[model samples]
Target: MQATNQSASAKPLSIRINRVLYGAFVLLSLYFFLNGSYQDAASNLGLALIFDPFNQMVRWENRPRWQRAWLLVHLLVMAGIGLVYWKTFSA
Candidate 1:
């Protein structure tokens, strides 16, 4: 009985987290795809290099779960910075 209630409560939380993760993935993918063609646009090389140490810290199955949280924060911060860069230069 208690187990059943716990499972029911967890389901909604999991679903909400999953939806946010999917949304972030789609947004990041779109940002990369649309901006990838330009040489002047920010390159993935820098990101890969910067985050390499964190990447190496995780085991395979658990990596995605951890990276998703890391990336969601990263995207929010970087997107804000990127927007500022764009606004500063493109003017």
Candidate 2:
């Protein structure tokens, strides 16, 4: 009974710790994104480009394979930016 009460009491503290850790990770990633030098941007951009669909057309296509691939690439880029943005505002 006492052990259960003690364990339950510790849950909030554990949650708080997790929150702090996540916040720190976000801030660090943002710092890398924003304060990162031109070389950093170039590297990340190059990495992003690798996933781009070279055969994709901007207009309508018979199949969505290229479109879907392009969308996935953009989504990843946006996610990266969002992480940085979230950190920029969180601070």
Who wins the TM-score comparison? 2
Model 1, residue 83: distance off in Å is 34
Kindly state the number of residue pairs that clash in model 1: 0
Candidate 2 residue-wise lDDT, 13-77, digit = tens = 76666556545544454556688663355335434443333333345456578666755655676
Clashes of 2: 0
Task: Quote the lDDT for 62 in model 2.
Answer: 62
Off by over 4 Å in 1: 37-91
Candidate 1: deviation at residue 16, Å? Answer: 0.3
RMSD of each: 9.2, 16.3
